[model samples]
Target: MERDKGKLELIATQRVNANSEMYKVVDFLNKSLKNYHLMFGLTKKDESMVISIYEVE
Candidate 1:
């Protein structure tokens, strides 16, 4: 499998609410890992809360 090196790529996702403990963890990871090239995002779509981890550019 070959993939671009610097492209924004999704690493993982979870169907969990942003108000849950999962969000806090993700937020912590973001704060702790922002300088390490990872980005965390939380969103609500279609009546569900979604969290995503990405390898940022």
Candidate 2:
């Protein structure tokens, strides 16, 4: 899951909150990403999160 962490890091950039729960981060990313020309695939693994992005059609 190291690759998934990298993906989240790239996506979140400097906006990541160190104290927030993974679910909260996922929710925030979900709303913010919806405003762009991209779509996201989110999966929760216990207390961690995995995000996948795809171009909008």
Candidate 3:
């Protein structure tokens, strides 16, 4: 039972780490997308970034 708990903890930690990395990727992508939109004059709001263009439309 202790071993199983340890494994579960490890899995949860890994998932949190993965989620952190994913969030970082999302931030980077959002910054890039915002830049692209600014270059194209597609968005005027400074808050818009990283989200899908279709969603904005």
How does model 3 fare in lDDT? 0.32
**Pairs clashing within candidate 2:** none
Which predicted model would earn the best lDDT? Answer: 1
Q: Provide the clash count, candidate 3.
A: 1
Across residues 1-57, which tens digit of lDDT does each residue of candidate 1 receive? Answer: 776677778999888544557668778989999888999888877657888889877
For model 1 the local lDDT of residue 37 reads 91
Candidate 2 residues 3-56, lDDT tens each?
Answer: 432232233222222344655656676688766645455565555556655555
Candidate rank order under lDDT = 1, 2, 3
The segments of candidate 3 whose C-alpha lies over 4 angstroms from its true place after superposition are: 1-18, 36-55
Q: Is candidate 1 or candidate 2 better by TM-score?
A: 1
- lDDT for 24 in candidate 3 is 60
Model 1 Cα shift for residue 57 (angstroms): 2.7
**Cα distance off (Å), candidate 2, residue 54:** 2.4
Order the candidates by TM-score, highest first. 1, 2, 3
Write down the TM-score of every candidate.
0.61, 0.38, 0.31
The TM-score, computed over Cα atoms with residue i paired to residue i, of candidate 3 is 0.31
Model 1 TM-score (2 dp): 0.61
